[model samples]
Structure formats: structure tokens, C-alpha cells
Target: MPITTEPHVAAKPALTTTVAREYVHRAALSEVLLTGWNKTGRDAFKVTAQWPRSHSFYVSEHGMHDPLLLCETVRQASTLLAHVGYHVPLGNQLSWSRVQFAVNPYALRTEGTPADIQLHVTCSDIRHHRGMPVTMSMHMEAVRRDCLLAVASVRFGSHSPAVYQRLRAGKGDVNEVFAQAPQPPEPVSRSTVGRLRKQDIVLAPTPDRLRWQLRVDTSHPVLFDHALDHVPGMLMLEAIRQAGHAIEPARGGAVMPTSMDVSFNRYVEFDEPCWIEAEPVETAAPSSDGRRTIRVAALQSGLCAVNATAELTDTVSL
Candidate 1:
């Protein structure tokens, strides 16, 4: 879809009116509501948003729904009240300045499909320092039933008086699209005692530099107690990340990897340690807001176990 920023319209309430008739793209909301997660008109200060299908919103090819896109959805939903002249003062504004998600592994599989989901988000506080206005804090949890799928938080900045006027006039140059931020280099940490170990260099990080070592312990989760067996793909990625951290500080300011495409070329089993060497195929660059992307590759035991690129940013709040 071409980029769009529609002008805000006022709404009116009346007797004998349908809910859909009172909202934008009611059909879309209807589909989302069918997923059984919406709670509309339940509270004077709260509202709900939902989608029936993953395709209803957006999904990426790397085996998961794009986290950045979901974050954007939450931002838009939260600001809908302000745009629709709810209790918020006229000209009040909110833009997602940061967001982060710590996701569960099993939920990772259902992400590409239209499974039921709900986001419970709350505004914790807002404050200002000197003349720089800052909206305090807000957190969101994506859940199915009582199980937590993901936990996220965001920070927003209210618009200034002049900026709000421009927005109302439909001439605002503001873009809520967050630009990716430069990912910080992974941090250095102590090495754990393990059966297999090797050191290598990482050329590409969301930040300019990254490097680390690969230590393998097939015994940690002994499959058969014979050999280490093939290392789980996710575990390998985790090891790569650990190695990367050795080169620099963990990208604390970075939005954790929302999705990853990994190709397993071979396996690193228990008895043998897999040494991985990694580097960025591309350098990090500025994204909307303060986010960034980095492309990286890894070699295990001289064999390419996984090769992939990752998008990273610090704009996301945790």
C-alpha cells in the first residue's frame, strides 16, 4: 500500500446507531473482533484492538510476524483516541518513540498464522525535563488465554503546540514511522567451561563492529549421553548472539531480533565443540526514529551452519 496519512474526522454518537457506523474501517475491526480478543466500550478510559488473521495485519517471511509492524499497530491504536477527540485535549499528540518485545519460543511458531491474540497496554506515566517534552511509559503484553506470548513497552513524545497546529491543518510533516536505530555492539562476558570452544571475528553488527567466540557443550542438554547430537537451531543462534556479545556490549538499546532466517548446513553435536566465526555482510545504517539493521553470517566448525541478516534498533523500549 502506498504511504497514507488520512485527515482526522470527528465522530458523533446517537441512539439506534451501529458500532461499526461510528468507527473507521469498521469491517476491519469486525474481522479482528471475531478472533475473540476485543473488549470495546467496556471502560470509560480503555479500548481494544484485534485482528482475526495474521494476514489481516502483516507477516514476514522469516517465520514470524514482524515485531516492528506490530509495534506500529499498537502505537496507532493508542493514539486513535487522541485523534478522535476523546478525553485528550485538542491538538494532543503521541508518537511511538520506542518499543521492545521479549517473546516466548513456542509462540514463535504460531506467529505466521492467524491465531487468537490480545494486547493489554497501559500508560504508566508522562513527564517533562527542562523544555524537552517526554511521555513517561507504556507497556503491552500479547497473550493467548493466560499464556504470555510477548511483553513489550513503548515511549511516546507529545507534539508541541506549533506541531499540533500543523497536524490539524493536515500539513504536518511529521512521520510516525520509526527509523531503525544503530544496534550497540554486543558486550564482553566471561567464557563458560565447555567441551568445545573456538574464537572468531564478527565484521557486521547493527553497530559498526562485533566479534565473539563459540563454545559448545553437547552435555548441557545431553540428548543421548553418547554424542552432543545436532544443536538446536535456536540454540545455535543464541550461541552466535552470545559470541557477538563478547565483542561489545549487548545491544541493550536494540529491539531484540523479531525474526530470523536460518539455514542449517550441518550439526554440532555433544562430544564436539562447534567454533563459529561471524561478521556483518553489511554495515548498520540509520532507520526511522533511531533504529537500524545489520546483516551477519556465521561459520561453524568451518561449515556454514547458519547464514542470515537481522534488523536492529534502539528505538524500541523494553
Candidate 2:
């Protein structure tokens, strides 16, 4: 995919130890989507960024900013707010409890456009204990050139480093879990996956109509950018997307996801065979525009690892 080399116009001064010391994420991981932030009030912040041609986690094969990246953006922005506004001791890990992504019909592609993006983040709820923020809720939007691209609602819980370490102690080595990369399975049909390329297909249908096996290629430059002990949450989201596409009729058109609500119940182990099962959720009435809702789950050892509900609409009539 092509990438733009133009620098972000609103890029802030390089992060320094003093500024990042209290950040929950460090180094490249700490690079917030926002170039700068202003405290609008006690519970609100105005954050801005010059949309970049590419991002480490946001870029996709189509050269557009993947919808999933907005989740991370909301995450970082939320943490930044907690640290800047509440004086919450930083360096605590945060894990998503619930996430909702609603894509605007006029979402912009970042491949070749230069646009200014702004986020207005408001803290909706904060559960505190012992003078520390234990959980937080935030609502934010990504607007480009006065057009809204997406809006996200997120709830997450903070975990201190010590607590996070203790929780992960028994997880064993992540590298070891990913050491054996499985070969790509037989490619599913383009009509079935809504993807033209085999490499992009994340689901391999099984005899059961509603069940499919998760397919992963560790060498995949984007999906498996680095060795991970468990399946990345983004891949699970992709699986949900693909599963929805497969079950929906193509006569209406290509599937365009409009909204998604996802919850991560547990880590999906890489060494185990993760199964994806999708079901159509009944709607009160048929959508005139060919929109449908799908509920998908990623299961391992018969236990749900992730649960997601996605709303998709046909892009064009066939």
C-alpha cells in the first residue's frame, strides 16, 4: 500500500521523558492520535491532530485508516484525559470493558488527503476507590474538515503495573505460544468472504454453517506485525466482519459496517483452535436500505473469548 510522507502539520514537539513519565503507554505506543490537547473544562478536553498518511496500527491494505484503529485512538485519548484532568497517577494499564464504534456515512480516507482531525472527549463516568480512578467511561468523536468520521463510546478499567504483572504471571511465555505459525488454510471464495484476496480472509468455513475456524498467518505483515502470545483483538473484529459478510446476501451490495459493539471476555490463546460462530439477530422489521445485524462470538475450548454485534448496510445494489 502507498503511504504519504508528508509530516503532520500539527505535530507536537517530540515526547520527552518528563512528559511521558506518567503516561500509561510508553515510546511509540504512547504516541496519542492527538497532536495537542486543551483543557476545556474540569471534565472535558479538546484534542487535535493533523491526519497522517499512515499510522502503525491504523493503516490498512486499502490505504484507508481501518475502522478498528478508532478504538485505540479513543483508548489513548481517554487515558490522556484521566492523566491530565484528574491527576490520576499514570503508568497504570487499562483494559477495555466495552467498546462501541459508529462510523459516519461520510467517513474520509486518510490515504492521500490532508485534513485536520479533532476530538471532543468528555468523561461520562468514573468509579473511584482509594483516591484512584478504577474505571472510566468516555465519549469521543473523530471529525475531519468539519465532517464526522466516527464516534466511539468506551468503558475501561485501570490496572496498576504490579496488578497487571501479577495477572499475567501465569500466562506463560507469549513468544512460545506463537512460535509455531500455522499455514494458511484453503482460501474461502471471494463472494463468501467479501475479500478479493485469499490472504485477507480470516475465516475458513466448516461443515457447520454457523461455525468457522480462525485462520492466522504469523508472517502477515499487518495482522501479525509482531509475535503475539494470543490472537489480537483486531483480528477477532475482522473475523466478525467477515462472518457477517458471508451470511448476508450480495444481491443488495457489498457490506459496509456502520456500527459495532464488542466486548472482550478473555484472551484467545494462539495455541488453541479458536472457532467463530455467527448468527443473524432478528430485527423488528426489515430495513429498507438492506441493513442487517449480526452477532458473532470467538470461542476457545467451548468458552467465549469475544462477543460482538455489528450492523452492516449494503453499499450498492448489484
Candidate 3:
């Protein structure tokens, strides 16, 4: 089938990501969709997929489905319609995406069946920012085996032509990239950096320790949707990472997460407000050599949702 690159107002050259080749699996795609697809734009779509249940790309020793990967699936599927109907051209590089909210049932202690997942998504309200057009937001959900796993609203935007070209030429200004873009209507918390919505804080604390909380709101991108009720395993890890960034002292030091060991206790969902608390339990030698250890805990309703230990290293100054 024709990939959804046709019918744009501007005949912008069709482009796809190298990352797509890595993530796209014909067998998985077929198992999820049941029917093969040609890239075509439709008003709505419901595709399915399955998890390996053994091997995994990152965490998940049993090959369980990943929340972030699920988000990627919905994102690609939703944007495929845009590529066919709207004029936004795909670029080789995708920048950091700001997740407005996500709701995953699999994260809520529900068994997942990827091949049986029912993905429902709709695209609308087009607008332009920084010379790039975007679908105001995406409303998406994932269901499988009679259980809803997740629902989320995700925001995506591309760099301006000038920014893209400059970066491509190796002459983009780093300061500009670090500068804050337009702030959202909601105010982020003082303890958080990248973003904050009520109890949820993004990029908070330091690289050594981190924590966050979940709040109830219609704007929550994923967890608010009706599939499953609780946070996913991957999101839990990311929350730790974001929280760690918030705690790490900004004295211009490089710290990157190298490893993590985590365990899930109970479900933390969007049904009500919940919080994540994390802190440093260990650190490496001061010789600037060796890995540093950090401890984290996520709590909901004053109960432990998840706990983890992370390994970090300082390569250089930030």
C-alpha cells in the first residue's frame, strides 16, 4: 500500500527516519494490525502489536511491553495520517518530545497482549509554531486482551527551517537550544526544571537522586485514558531519570544513567493524585572514576509504587 506521503499541499520530498527502520518489524506490525497496510492517511486508526515476552530492548527481563515504545507506536501511527493529509514533512532527526500526559494499563499491573492491542487515535486542530506545522495534539489509547493499557495526549513539534539547517551545518548555537522556549500556561514547580503539572515533575533533583508524583487532570496524556490504570514500568524509570536530573547539582558536571535495578510494588494511576519520592543512597569515589549509585522510590496514596537503584557516571562538566 502507498505509504501516507501523498496529497500534501506542498509536494515536500517524502522522508522517513533511520530509527523507523530499527523499530519497524513486519511480523510485529502484521501481528498487531492483522491486516497489512500501505502508508495511507485515514481519519482514525486502530492497530495492534505484541510483546516478545522474553527479550527486551532495555529493561523488562521478561520482555514485557514498554510504555515509551507504546507511545512511539501511537505517535508513528497518528503521524502517518498527517504525512498523507497534512503538509508536515518527516525529518531524519526527532528532537526531545514533551509528553503532555500518558495513561497505560500495562503500567497499572495489567497483563498485556500486544498482538491483541486495540489502538484508537484521532488527529485534529492543526497549527504552526516556529515555521513548522503540527497537529495541536494527539489523543491516543491502547487496549489489549479485553483490558485497557494506556491513554495519552502527546505534543510534538519540529525545529524551524533555520534551526534545522544550522544544526545540519554544524553551526547551531548551543545557547539557543538550552534557552527556554515559550512557557506553557501551567507553571512548572520550583523543584522541577523541564516541566511540571501538579504532582508530576520532569527533570527534577540531580542526576544522583530523583522523585515525582502523579496528579489527576484531563490533560494527562497517557494514564488518563481508559485502558489500564497505573503507571508503566518504563515511565517509572523515566520519572526517576527526570527526577534525578532535578536533584543533581548544576555545577557543570556530566552525569548519565548507566544502569538501573527496579521493582514494582503497586499500581500508581491517574485516578487520584500520587507522588514519587527519591534520594541518593550511594556514590562513587571522588577521584571522578567509577560509577555512582542512586536510590529512588515512587509512592501513591502514601504507599510504595516502585523502588529502584541507578548507576551513574560523570564523563565531563555540563
Candidate 4:
């Protein structure tokens, strides 16, 4: 009889603390939403965090947590996966392709009591070419005391720092470009933006019902405590939410976002006139609870910068 040999498979290396340290930064604990994390599997992690009451980012004068904070939470959780076993390179610039986040409007408040937030994250849809990871996707669920607060789906790509630096160099110094004070638009009716206060309204209506202008006041204590070279991504997300509120009136007189899918095609610079346009996407009839979807786009220099689709529901008084 002829002898046959089988090929042997090599086992994956176990995760080590040293390797984790290279990707996880301690500074994020104070600056970002990350508080701590624990490895649960080869591609899964459990993250813990608490919303800050007075952080320069994401805090509102009303003491309510901004919906944008959920996006950051999802970003941090995805980064945590890089430490355990994902092939994320150190010092790489993380970019998003698509992000979808959904929240339970009734459980959106996070001001008075310190809510213990737990995030369960799983990394999947990893695509590699030439033995290098080109893209990956993550799914996360945020909970407080067993109550589902939010869920998110995010797709990310890693870019070399050299490429990012070279691209940004063409634009003026980042600090100088973003240092301009926010210019508030002429006062508009509160109902125009579905906001109760003038300070909270971020959109200025135009003659066209579907078109509005971006009104960013960098001087606002909560929205612009720090300066930058461009409009922050959070502001773009808020603009979409506010635009949805303006276009789609909630059946019960309160517009609460229940779901959102957003994609950023480019950055919106501060010096340019950014226009926001919103329209209703025909979908199945509104649910019994009055949930409906709106499509919004942020355009700069006649180019689309950010596109979003959001679902809103009436506020449920607790």
C-alpha cells in the first residue's frame, strides 16, 4: 500500500495582554465613552461605560444625552474588538462606510441617575485581500439593567496615517480652519425645527419646504467647547434628526428618533454653506405607533456630504 500524508493546520495564537496594550489607549477612558472592557470570545467583547454629565462632547443643557453619543459608543466598542483578536493596525485612521443605530425613545434619557450601560459587541463580515484586512463590520447592543437602550450596525475601513495626513495637508491648518465662531442664522419659528428653544434649533428653513441651511454656533457651550478644522460628524447626525422633526410631525406631537442609518461621503467644512434637504421615503403605512421614515441629505458645494434615513415615533411619556 502507498503511504499518504495529511497537511497539518496551525492553531491561531492566543491573545496576550502585551498585544492588547498596543491597540487600547488609556487616554480614551477620560475623553471617549470607553470606561472598561472584557474579552468574551475571539471576536466578541463586553464594554461598560457611563455618560458624562458635563463632558465637552455630547452633553446638552437640558441634561439629556445626545443621540450622537450612541454613535460614539458604537465606535469605541468596535475599536475594543481590535485589541482582542482583530487585525487592526496601530495608529491607523478609522473611517466609517455605513452606520445604523436604533434606540428606544422611552429609555433615551440619561441625566439624573447614573445609568450603568453595558454594550455587547461582535465583529464580523471581515474582508481581506492580499492577507491584509481591508474592511470589517460590527454589531452592538447597548443595555441598561437588562433594558435595551440602543442597537447599532457599523462598517469600518482602516487607512494609513500617512494617507490621511497627506490628504488633510491640502486643507488649511486644521486648528485655524475650525476656529471660526459658529454663525447663528436669523431666528425662525420654534415649530419650524420642532424644537422648543431657539438655542436648540439647528436648521434654518428656506423657501423650499424640503431645503434648510446649516446653523452651527460653535460658541454654544455644549456643541462647541472645543474647536476643529471641520464640522464634527455628530453635528451632521443631529442636523438629520432635526430635519426629520421639521418635515415629519409626530402623531402625538413629539418627535423621538427610533432608528437611523447614516453614511458620510465627505467632510463638511465650516467656511462653506452646507444645505440640508429632507424628503419622506414611501414605505409601508405608518405603524400603529406612528413610526415613519424620512430621508435627509447634507450637501456642500453642490455635492452630497452626508446621507441619512431615519425613523421617528411619538414620545412615550414615562
Candidate 5:
């Protein structure tokens, strides 16, 4: 089958329905954010998505869409492009290397209805194998009815089943590893993590006060929609979000993410405790709008598994 790259055109409303769950490697249709995509030029695409006003997992932060939702949208859009644009097989495994996203806080404000988004994505640094894409990075801007919502990037490796099996040698059985995943630890306070439910909190208190243990709940409908041998990237990303709130002084329980730049150095196994730590990067000199930067890391097996730097702000310009 050949995937065509036609010139860009206006998005069709009829294509607004969520795409197949498998296209983005998600288990549930609700987890799918992308509506559709059209190749605009070589390595360029236009992808459409929707952000519901109310979501159980990606809840609103002070009436604004969750920044991690933007990250998820970018992840899904990029993955979808990998499949339709580059013809990557659904059986292939995608190991994300990095995810970087920065959203315009003002643009995330929810109106009286759901938000429709259009992303202009361009891929680069592509590596091919046997005529199929092996790895690539996507840079895109998320727009909402002409308002720019976010700019993001995602880099991942596409591995065939054989290569993935070799990579996961011992943990190749996803179902077994998923079922064997450790029980989630007691979560931090809802107010502390800016979450309403204990299940949504991804951090457990530690003796150090500044550090927390990563909470992995395999039963999570959204995060663990479908299971795998290793801890998924999105879970680690949520850990960073909780840690950021834990590090900040609570004020009206409102702090939305402005940006997040993260890199995955190694896989976070389901069997170990990954320590999450956060430190302020720019505490003394805050931005005019009260934005602050924080550095967060996930450590496991005495090694850094993931690292991220993110910006936070309390105000959402409506």
C-alpha cells in the first residue's frame, strides 16, 4: 500500500471523528486525540485533533486544558504521521526518545465548548531501514481556530517485532509484565499534586521531602490504556507534572505548565522504584507573568532514566 502526499487543503469536518485506536497505538478510542491528517508536502503534514472540555485524566488546570494533553496530542499526531505518512507497520514498536512541548497559556483557555486543534507538522532527521522509516523527529504547532495553542516536538524509534523482541529479550511478554507490574504506592495529597483523585496523583512522599517515588498503576484506564513491558513515557511525564507541583508553593492550587523539554535516557522498568526529584531553575528571577522554570528527573536502578525542564505559571490569560 502506498501513502500519498497531496498538497495541503482545508480540513474537512467529516474527518473530525477520532481515528482508529491502533493508528496511534492507544487501546481506547477516548485516548485518541487525532481526528485526521493529510500530507501537505514531503515530510510535512496537517493533523486535526480535539480537546474535550472535561476529561477524567487530562483534567483542566484552572479552567485551562492540561499541558500534558498538548503533549499527548503531539505524541499521537506524530505517531499517526509515522504510520500513514511513512507507512510504518502497526506491528512495529515505537520507542520515544524525546518529547518537547511549549504551550501558549492564553490559547488553552476553554470556552463554553470543546476545542478543535490543527497541527502543522514537519519531520526531519529521518532514518530509514529497508525502505521503512526507522526514526524521525516531528516539529509542529498546535492551532485552535487560528489561535496558536502550542509548539511541540517528538522523536521516536520504530522497531520491527523482531528488533523489539531482541530489545526486550527478557521482558518480551507484554501481558505478563503488565500483569506483574507492582501495585501503585499511596499517592500524595490531592491538593499537593493539584489533582482531585488519589489515583491521578503519580507521586508518593519520600523522606527527603523534595523527592517522591513514581507511582505506577497498571489499572489506570488512560495511562495504562494498553500495557507493555516497560513503564510508558506518558506516565513518567505525569510524574514530572506532579513533582513540579510538589516543588512549588501551593497558591490557589493553580499552576499550569508553560513548557516541558524532556529526554528519555533509558527504559523505566515496571519492577523497580523510580525516584522523582525536582529543583527550581529560575527561582530568583521570575518572568513578568510570574512564570518559573523547574528541572525534574526520574531515576531508577541508580541511573537517570528520564530528565526534564519545564516552565510553570499560575495565570491563564482569558
Candidate 6:
């Protein structure tokens, strides 16, 4: 895929430490992007994050940060605010119901230093259970040196341990399901998915060009940072993004996912074969710059696991 490079900006000094890994549910501090945050008003805050110039994943051509990186950053910030700002119990599990992100291609740039980020976040549609917030929505703007990089939002719900346990109704539990999952099928060519590393490619070839078998790699360091009973929602988001790339005829990595609006309908199981399918969003108006749009769906057991509309652009919009 072709990517436009922006003028490099010098790094400015900022917070030096990341938040606790537990707050963001990350097993490694190396994966944490949030640096600090402070409450500004009721259900509002100012948060800071930093993106590394070089990461194992989350980068496109010319070192421009990938949009998925921003997605992950917002995901982390959401959990952090829930745990510390909202006082949700540490043991409670948070899951996103909806997630959307849009980026300006010009703002995805880097020199030799990390990108220092500032986000203004506000929460809404809060619903409480037992005097604690059980569900909420967050909207945030990601800025770098006064430049608007991206804007994103997430609607998520938090469930207590007991409630979460009851929600699991599959074969055995998550661990057993994960253990029984078949070996990951061979992935398509790294170049086909616009990935430099083979392990990062998440699609397996199928006879039908518009569809692919979802390749689940539970051992992947970043996506599967910790074990769970089901496939992580982020992984499904990624599968759709890749599906958009492959669904385009004659466009492999050429069709790159720049922005995505995803609604996770159900948990994607580990032991079953999940299919990623894509279709063009003909009703949706195209961007002035001629960006292609596609709706991708994850199908497991003939049911939609996720429904997402992804905007594709030739230039890097991460």
C-alpha cells in the first residue's frame, strides 16, 4: 500500500512513565501507551499518551503509526478511566460494544522520537448497577503538537466476576476452548495483507476471494497478551480490516483500512472456524478523495460475530 509521509516534528518532553498494566488489562508494561491523566470535570478528563516510533506492529509504510495503534490507545484509555476515575472494581471485566475511529492522513507522522499525545475525553450514557457504573460511552480527540490526529469513541460495559462467569455458555470454559482450538492455518502472503511480518497477517486463504478463514493465533504477543476463553474483540476488528484489503479485486494491501466503525454482536469462539466476509458499502457516500468503503462481517456458526464498516484509502491514514 502507498503511504504519504509527513514533515517530521521534533519531540517535546512529557510524562516519563506509563499507567499500571492492570488498569489497561495489559500483561506487559511495554504495551501500555497511556502516560497520565487528570479529571477535568464530571465524567470528563484530559489524558496523555505516547506512541513509539518503532513497534512490532501498528506501523505502516515510512514509520507512520497505524490507525489500529490509535484504536488500541483509546481502548487502553477507556479502561484506565473506568478503573481509576469511575472507581469500577479492579476484578470487573470491560468489553467494548461499539468502537469508531477516524484519522487525518497528514497527522500520522514521526521522526526519530515518540509521538507525544494529548486527548480530551468525555464520558456519557452512563448506566449504574449497585451504585457503580456498569456501562458508559467515551468520546476523545487525539492531538499532537496542536495538530488533530484522530477522533474516536467507544461504548463499553463492565461486568462483575460472577456475572461474567454466568455469561460463559460455550464448551467447557475459555481455557478449555482455547486449548481445543485447531492449529492456526497458514496465513496468506505478508505482502498481501500489507504486513511486513508473517505472524501479523490474520487471514487464511479460501477458495472464494471475498471470504477468508479467520486465522487465530492465541500465542500472538500483542493481540493475545493474556489468555481468555474467546477470541479477543480486537482480533476480530483486525480480521475485518484485513478482509477489506483482500476483498478488493486486484488490490491486496493497496486497499488499506484507514477508519473503522465496528459493532461487536457476540463473542467469537476459539474452537470453531470463523469466516471473515466482506461486501462493498454502496449506499454510503464516498469521501471527496475517493476513499473506498466496505462492510465486513465475521461469521461463526452462521451468526454475525461482528459487523464493521471500514473506510479504505490509498494513502496512509493511521
Q: Return the top candidate by TM-score.
A: 5
Q: Tens digit of lDDT per residue, candidate 3, span 155-269?
A: 4444455656765454244334223222213323644432323434332222233344432333334322222223444456566655555556323433344445556665454
Q: Rank the candidates by TM-score, best first.
A: 5, 6, 2, 4, 3, 1
Give the Cα-based TM-score of candidate 2 against the true structure. Answer: 0.76
Looking at model 5, residue 83 earns an lDDT score of 89
Candidate 4 backbone overlaps, count: 2
Q: How many residue pairs clash in each candidate?
A: 27, 0, 44, 2, 0, 1
Mark the regions of model 4 whose C-alpha exceeds 4 Å error after superposition: 1-32, 52-67, 79-92, 106-112, 127-134, 180-184, 196-199, 220-225, 249-253, 316-318
Query: Candidate 4 versus the native: TM-score?
Result: 0.75
The TM-scores of all predictions, comma-separated, are 0.38, 0.76, 0.40, 0.75, 0.93, 0.89
Every candidate's lDDT: 0.41, 0.72, 0.45, 0.71, 0.86, 0.84
Candidate 6 Cα deviation (angstroms), residue 283: 7.2
- Candidate 6 per-residue C-alpha lDDT over 189-283 given as tens digits, one digit per residue, 9 for 90 to 100: 76667666777889999988888999998889999887777888878877877777666522322444568999988888877899988898775
Predicted candidate 4 versus true structure: per-residue lDDT over 262-289, tens digit per residue: 9989878777889999998887665667
Better of 1 and 3 by TM-score: 3
Model 3 residue 298 lDDT score: 75
Per-residue C-alpha lDDT of model 2 across residues 112-198, encoded as one tens digit per residue: 654466888888688887888888888887887788888888888877877776876765665766786567577568779677667
Tens-place lDDT per residue, model 1, 197-229, is: 222121222332353333433333211122212
Q: How does model 4 fare in lDDT?
A: 0.71
For candidate 5, write residues 1-318 as lDDT tens digits: 999998899886752478888989898887888888898998899999988998899987677888889888888887788888898999999988999988888788888988999999999999998898899999998999898888999999999999989888888589988998889889888878888888888899889878999998888889888868888898988888778778875466477778889999999998989999899895656577767789998999999999999888875423
- Tell me the alpha-carbon RMSD of every candidate: 20.4, 8.6, 18.5, 10.3, 6.8, 9.4
